[model samples]
Target: MMVAASEILKPTGQKPAALTIDGLSLEFPTYAGAIKALDDVTIEIGASEIVGLVGESGCGKSVTTMAATRLLPEGRYRVTAGSIRLFGRDPFAMDETELQDVRGKLVSTIFQEPMSALNPTIRIGRQLVGVIQRHEAVSEAEAERTARGILKDMLIAEPERIMRAYPFELSGGMRQRVLIAMAFSCNPGLIIADEPTTALDVTVQAVILRLILDRAKRTGTSVVFISHNIAVVSQLCDRLYVMYAGRIVESGPTRAVLEAPQHPYTQALLRCLPERVEPKAELEAIPGTVPNLLDPPPGCFYRPRCPEANDQCFAKPPSMAPAPDHIVACWRRETIQPSIKASEATQ
Candidate 1:
């Protein structure tokens, strides 16, 4: 295996940060020209921080993760430009074998679907053992022991028996736990969890999310948790990046972004939450749908949907700047205050 020797999850915590993505823009060449899936996307994850990439469906959040890991599928997608550096190594330039080592050993991932991720034909133990043995120079017996230990740590009961069973034999929650075990088995520096709880129930989701958080917190494993649920992001992320279309419209400390969103899109997203936001009141909703990415507008992609959008929004693009750690890309954010303020006045 060709695992990079410099991953950040070292026991001493002395390694450099896990990743740094700069002005990353990934485009897909369709028959209808380039679809700008990611427009100047930039974010970072420290060695031990859990950052949330929050956005609506098809906002390029998952695409960003897939591109960063060099896992983009055949012909359907192409990265026109951008840089994704993992442990200071460029993922885009790495060879296939090199990428494989980085994927399972240094940086692991958990997809939205657990059943598909876990092999149906193989026993759970065999799958786990394969993952470990793929990276480590260990005998089958040793690999099996390590795999069993990892599963047990994930709170999987009867690890020995569960390992011997197939993926179909386990419940959904159990299957998710097994996937989590696999991701963390290599002691990866970064875990890209792409909506890890989507297939799980509410209570099960909570348990799984908590497990992920507790594991990362204990292991000092940095995570890039991508989800469309703002409420969930509020609970788990130390920092939040709000994506609209293909760009980051707002970003800041989770509390700041959640409590006092600055951008029109951000405010709209908060308003769109279901009823009972406060102690005993119905929640407001954000009006309008997301912009089309295949043929994005001339200026701001959100102009059509932004309540505060004006001539300037259609004139030229707005740049990110001094909005505390918080940032808003709306042309009228300077004059746009969250409706939460106006709602209080009426009350």
Candidate 2:
């Protein structure tokens, strides 16, 4: 029986999403107890779309993406429920050999801290060329040529010099750009940028973001950009998901979420932004600390920190779409819906 690759990839008879994480719940087991890292996290990204995962530290943004890619250490964690799909294929079902073929070829990740990602001993050019050759069956000359072209696209000066230099020789910005170039080098369908610009200066961060956006647009690649800075994501992402503790409290188009966030946690996060406060006024901070994952609080994870929480918030809220394409999980959706409508009317 002969079967085309397209048919095998699209068994459902529809164009598959770039990435899908459906009702995923995960935990890390320790000697004392298991840590609930992600709970019912669901997200779907289409081809060429840029999605942002934003939250405070320890909010499971990194864990969710790492789980989707199966980069987490085996046996150290468990998926209690749910499924992950990359281009309609289950990552957890694949063996190491299959994962190796899928990782760089189908999906790639641009991690934080470029210095840690790159090898200190190898010249930048050779490293880039090696990655290009790994997933692609190209000659050394061709790989080197592609590496140089991608470096040029990153707007690096003296591509030849950069290729010859070691990882330690490049500045922080240059090193991050090299990493971005490497991520796009394989031309994967999906790219997970896990806070790629968090280490750079503000100026360099803007440049790095612009380069990523432009490259992804040109290549038609879907991007999952993880960050703690809501403002940064607002500038780069088409859609936004706001995570609190281990659950997504709000998710919608970037403009809609920014204009009228429905969840109390989301509203508090936006209020804490410095730009939203008057000059010299103290910036508002979300009260209360993130609950310990080992034995998380009952019901809504954000209830403790949410000032507007009522008795009803003691129970977990189901995810609801108050407006088309905008989903939020919060107990106060009924009351908040009117405010969202009012904001829309005013616009």
Candidate 3:
């Protein structure tokens, strides 16, 4: 049986959330007019909590986090609206110098591909040491010791040998572990893991997930895990936000959302899970493709593909909370309250 995240995650006190993105709307400017990449996106991650951002490709999951970290290229995109507070400081107003300090010291990112994230020319030791030394004031020898310690903590045997090897020398899984070590080397307040295990096999993927949860829980670090895999998110995240066509269609505690999904898009995605199907039966797939953002239709972007969409869906529905802490943007939300309550009662 899968352990619930509520059982393992630390309790967040009255302190402000580690990260907050409110009413975020951004567009990428190109020769073919602006493409609205994010639409009124909002998310909050509490201290020491693990939140999952799940969606199909082109749903703006990566863009939302990238914009929060100010990693998107300069002058190429426009934030039409929204504010981001990282540990109570506004990242949008920060300068490059301040951002440099914030990126590694306060917030670190574990990219999807380890090879692309790690430098091929640099040895793993030098790269790890560089991150530690850059973020905190320490001697070269001291940084090296810290790097080695972290590598050992990651369960990378023969730390000395591994550190001396360049990025190209290690396997994908090993390189990813190195990246995870580097992300945790400085003990950042939050870690954004953007599909860090996509390239690995199932066994390696499970190990990577366990390592991330273990380390984050131990260090009191908050994490925003971004992925298209709802099954992985269900197993690991305390809270989940489901996105469709740049807008958050559903969000709540993981168990709550998974047990009684309110949005049609979410239900469709869940149906696509292989575990839900009979053995040897054909897998289900969401019928329509994600909408084009450049010339998106008015009101709900998902209405075009939603099976349950009605006349009310033509005009975007306001967020509704049929259950406490469970929010969905669907005109039919009120009518589903009875089913949600019955499910809860049974649980």
Candidate 4:
């Protein structure tokens, strides 16, 4: 039986975040100069919440996840500021051996491309068994049996046959299922799914999303679900963080942000969704391109494209303004809400 996402809840009061990223700033050097990939980005995922990180390409969504996993390349990527804690422990401070133990065992990741993530040379069964044995003190036979059982749970038919087949032999959907099985096999406390369904068909995409949500709920695992599709994020996540130009422009409970977005960038994002358009009307697209990280705008990065931008936006960067459960980084957040409300009312 599949567990409902709503049923997965953290107990109230002082519970540490499963994953906490505080004032994280990362930069990469190039001939042009240093490019800030992330800038003072802060986010938190509770022990059992499925939080969605939504943004367009090059908004630093994937980079944030890589940083959380301690997978950022040395020398190429530098952490300029801030900290990342996984279940109360700083992953950055851990030694190589400790970091390895934290990965796969404490936190697992489902990459965007299953083909790239899985080894074509190794048989599927051996890969799954290897992950299980590495994290658990199980015999080879026991590990193989556990792998088969996990495949069965993922609704794969003939789990034994799949184990023997190489990654090249399976369909795209099957390969993704294998990766999901490997991720959940260790019962990791946190799972970072970085666009796990981007390559699959609509039907298969729905199935994969359900599997991830159900498995997370059943195991009480916190999930950071990253995606470019706002619709998909709205459907699956309890909370949402809207990223733009390497900064989180807005964030709040999924329903609140989706229903009445305050930031102009987030409002434009919603306007671009297909469902928001009338049958004959043209699809909306946000104007202007993502800012060049090598030389981003000094104040508000989205000021060039924001309809509500003004002199204040150009003079000083906007900080996160609290609004009930929502947090928006826009100087005009108060003034923008009424206009958005009127526009929504007209629609």
Better of 3 and 4 by lDDT: 4
Q: lDDT for every model?
A: 0.81, 0.85, 0.85, 0.87
lDDT of 4 at 44: 81
Which order, best to worst by lDDT?
4, 3, 2, 1
**Residue 11 error for model 2, in Å?**
19
Off by over 4 Å in 4: 1-14, 338-347
| lDDT per residue (tens digit) for residues 161-244 in model 1 | 999899999999999999999999899999999999988899999988999999999998999999998878988988878998
Over 4 Å off, model 1: 1-15, 275-283, 341-347
TM per prediction: 0.90, 0.92, 0.92, 0.93
* lDDT digits (tens) for residues 193-256 of candidate 3: 9999989999999999999999999998999999998879988999998998888888888988
- Once model 1 is optimally superposed onto the true structure by TM-score, how far is the C-alpha of residue 121 displaced, in angstroms? 0.6
Q: Which ten residues in a row have the lowest lDDT in candidate 1?
A: 1-10
Candidate 1 is scored at a TM of 0.90
Q: Which candidate ranks first by TM-score, i.e. highest?
A: 4
Model 1, residue 88: C-alpha shift (Å): 0.6
Number of the predicted model whose lDDT against the real structure is largest = 4
Q: How close is candidate 2 to the true structure, as a TM-score?
A: 0.92
Candidate 3 TM-score over all chains jointly: 0.92
